[model samples]
Target: MPPCASPLLLRRRLSTRPPHREHPKLAALLDVLNPPPPSSTPLPHALSSAFPSPSDAFPLRTLPRLLPRLPSPLLSLRFLLWRLTASTPQPSPHALSSLATSLPDLSSSVPLLLSSSPQPLPLQHYALLLNLSTHAGLFPASLAVLRHMRSFGLVPDAACFHHALRAAGSAADVSAVLEIMSGSGASPTVPVIVTAVHKLASAGNFESARRLIDKMPEFGCVPNAVVYTAMLDGMYNFGNLDGAVRLIEEMEGSGLGANCAPNVVTYTCLVKCLFGKGRVAEALGVLDRMAGRGVMPNRVFVQTLLEGVCMEQRVADTYNVVERVVGDRGMSSEQCYNVLLICLWRVGMTAEAEGLAQRMMKKGVQLSPLAGSSMVRELCVRKRSLDAYHWLGMMEENGVLCDSNVYGTLLLGLCEEGHLHEASALGRKVVEREIHIEASCAERLVELLKQYGDEELASHLLGLKQRPGGLSF
Candidate 1:
């Protein structure tokens, strides 16, 4: 056996372990302190006496569980400051959610959190405050939190900056966030710069936005195609079509490299904007230029062009555009026609839409999910949900995925038409796929099912509605 250790040696050995252990007495003290502010806060002598080792560090692990139980946000915040010194065991999401909800005004609480501790708060905690403040729509308070972080020499990472940017409501708000980023010596990335520019331009602060874009090189950030695309979007959104056109021309003439070249998105915006102004010929020219540059159009580009022409009641022009894109071999003829099907329905060309639908179904052409959904929707609108239900079966057999909205629409239409057996079959499909429908649709269907004495099926539909992770609209 080893010799017994001396008292000082024993103390030193004990100190190597975690400072404090989970203690029932401390928890009891906290429980008894309900709705009572400590005359002296942050482990007052009364509270400290309950700890096994009064001189030991606070038990940080117990704080997260006890946070919600605390009577006031101030007490919880005080405990948080104490634990911020240690890096491990960050606050849990539930704890943060509770704390954020309890605090009446985060703006005031931020300063209190900052001033309570002498040592710098961990960057994570500051990020938590920023997230809470911004998510609450308290943009000014979020800015203040960021300012305090900079004052403490803490630099926020990209994600934290994004949280603040999302909450920014105007040009001034965006500028303030950028100023904080600059002051912290954290260079904004290209995406961050684009978001800032978009925000500024959206508020009609075009000059400020332009200045930011021009100054990108100052921070070693080059404006890529995406950045230029955002600028074009802003100009078009603000009714500055000419400005957008000129910007695209400049982008085309810049000859910087592929990074600066107009891609599919750039051409899409130009086409949509020009089409919006009834310049169909000019829009076609832009598409020509895009093809000439060896930039291929994607599905969205084709969809936008089809929708634009369809909106103008240019049916022949619509088919011509589709044929032209199909000939380019960039997109399949089936996908192009699927998009045209959606466009035809949108423009209320019902006869043409029905004829095209019949041809596609007879040919067993694989229907895109959007096209399948569109066909079901149009049939239901004509009070033909029986037909919609059959259509869904065929689409499913062909392996076309139908989304929740499509199912819900058909289910509701069937119930409204008193087609119980069909609605029941669809509801079972919903449960089999574990899909969620709108709450309103589910409730209505459930009521009709129970009224018709289908108790078991009704409960299953309710289960679908209450299922975890189910997508509802």
Candidate 2:
């Protein structure tokens, strides 16, 4: 008998008799001797020799036998192997390659074992596979792992599903993710579904996004503030303002507050929709309603309203809104003044605009380039040429550098008003300071001189232009 068969012979005897023949005892012995060919060979001793001692070896040997007696020997063996190997210091590339080569059959059997096993895969393995699949962009392989997870009666938590969805979204393969969820009969929570909807909306697949929203209830999903906001933003972005408003109304009817009190996004979205439809009066009414319901308009909302008023040429109303925002503690001083100056300038109210600029100056609020430029243009438009000149002089004197465009505007305005002496002086100052004058501005100045019948001065300006280096005058 083979040396390994000694232990079995001590436990039972065998004889050379066919089991189907008349000798029943001999047949039993023959059956014991020949035990049908093993379904699989035992893993090599070297592989199993990962254990530190012989006492540790008994469990590996007796585990299959003890499985019926001890409930989870396979799990215990897996744990032991992982503890011994995976938790050690990081493996060298050669070690990893050797392990990979040695475990080819084991690797093939893992999926089969995982599929047939009643227990879920260990958390560590799942996490490792997830990270691998993400980096590799291996969607099909990831789906296989997730399928095995389900087969083992495991339910992934929200975070697991969220990460998987994010991976699929990154790969631009949303359908694969959908199929996995469908096959598992698992429904992602509101936030998970909203995240997917947002991705679809960004991809310009509004119809699919809407369909996903419609399917929310079937998955026992309810739209929270985030979900509602995502849907509203999607509809608004796609020019489905009416649909966005209807969703708001539906949210209200479902006992979600239509009042802007708890949900500023819904109210803001509605306000934007109103403005989009050119319903300025209705939009203002909505703002008032938002205010009454204690939904304080954020900077964005207030800015939108101010912009609408500017578009509609409602300067007085826009100014009122700006004042209201300035009165609020949270709004930035710079943004408030900037929008106010723009609205004032848009409606030809240079006087009011100048007042705003003076207020900002007194308060030590820094003006944005846009606000500064707008104020300067208003100064020139009102024929306050000296005011424009003084403002530019003050900016330079105070060491506040203005953009070249600001200087260009001032020079062009001075020339148009037949102030060639001042225009030439300013042009010389620009050239001396190395401030750039666009080619367009030079041409415009020449045109202005011809229009004013100052050909001699125009020729002088033309001569200055021909100089090799920029001239200030």
Candidate 3:
């Protein structure tokens, strides 16, 4: 029999062997642990007789390859337990990773691994187990792993704490939150505590969330703007408007310095909440208040404001809001005008929309493609195809690109209006530009030409159907 060697020597010896070939002693041990069929003595006796020395530990690297050769996972697990609980130095990170990957089922392996480690595994190993458990949707198992780490006096990293809090859902208690701040092997952190508060508040445990924030200063963690904002968002989502407003006022009024002041996101959440509750005037007031505080609006805030104003059909209010945003330079005048123009059309204010479009054009404000499309659609809907075509020509002159839908609408409208010559001219231009018409519009145009007995015009348009790039229909 080969003599017993230190783990380092065993590794060196195994490294010299050919790839995928176990050392002689390791192969014999495998045979002892999993004897051929039913011919074995008891496993403990066989293992002791084959390897008499207590120091006869195997190389960690070979464990991954050894696991598959064993007859049962339980036996493999036993070997892992023996190696983990042995008096040998802790396993290398690489070997631990290899062992973890070799296990077929992470969820099943977690419990066995935890039980086997009387001596706690490395912090990284526990962290890895926590991550695996959370990702497997084993929230209870993840919490168990967290408690196990805490019991072992391991200070889990912030990421591990975060994963635990996230998977805890609404079930995570105030004790766990306080322990992170005041317990041994852990330090109070803003992000982790904020995550806990967010989860608690979102679960409608406002009293506990408030208690946590109130106790923050005792733990050397002053609640900052992000923490307050998270609480406000939770209140907003659950329709606790009065509580949300009160919290906002507290955040703004507190003497926690600039870091705790209400920000753009804070105000935006309030505005959205107000608008959601049909309090349009109050929402607008929040916007004005936000500007007065010298906080600039972000893109999401602008979009929310426009969507809310438009949905309320507050046309005059929308114009005022647009001018306010434009003057504040929160968004470009062109961008604001385009959104306002679409809102006007959507609310059935066609005349007002036309007047706005003309004013925008005179001011050299470029119209968005959507605005142009909206104008063409409104005109055609009113049975004014001739004017739509004229508008399309004007758009082209102003270097505004009209989408293919605009052209298709114009073609069908002209055909329906009995203007075959004008339709033919537009059809040729469409083909020349290689703009593909929608399938329905193309078929309808063809049917109209055929009915008019304009065989030449119909044939010319039909030629587009054969070209792959010419017409979608």
Question: Could you tell me every candidate's TM-score relative to the true structure?
Answer: 0.74, 0.42, 0.51
Q: lDDT tens digits, residues 1-473, model 2?
A: 12233424523433322332222232322232234577252322323434344234332222222212211223323333343344444333343333323332333334444565566666656644444344444455456667777766676666556556655643256666676677777787887788777666655676777788778778886546667677677677667777777766666564654332236677777777788889888877765666655666676676677777777877788767766766754366677767667766866766667776777777777777676777676777777766788777655554556666677678888987767777777867865665655556767877887887767655544444421123333
Instruction: List the global CA lDDT of all models.
Output: 0.74, 0.59, 0.71
Residue 208 in model 2: lDDT: 79
Pairs with backbone N, CA or C atoms under 3 Å apart (clashes), candidate 2: 427-472, 428-472, 428-473, 429-472
In model 1, how large is the Cα lDDT of residue 470? 37
* Cα TM-score of candidate 2: 0.42
lDDT of 3 by residue, 1-473 (tens): 23334434544564566435343466565556645577747554566677665244555555676664444444555555545434556555555556655644555556766775677766655665665455555566566677777777877777787766755656355356346535655665777778777777877888877787777787678878888888888787667888888888877775656788998888888888888899898988876788778888876677677768877877788888888888998889888888878767776778778889889989899998988998888888888888888878888899888777788889889999977777888988977876666656667888998898877766656555422123233
Judging by TM-score against the true structure, name the best candidate: 1
In candidate 3, stretches whose alpha carbon ends up further than 4 angstroms from where it belongs are 1-138, 171-182, 254-258, 334-473
C-alpha RMSD for every candidate: 11.8, 25.1, 16.6
| Shift in Å, residue 49, candidate 2 | 62
Per model, how many backbone clashes are there? 0, 4, 0
- State in Å the error of residue 239, model 1: 1.8
lDDT tens per residue, model 1, 183-250: 88888887888888777766778888888888889878887888878878877877778988988888
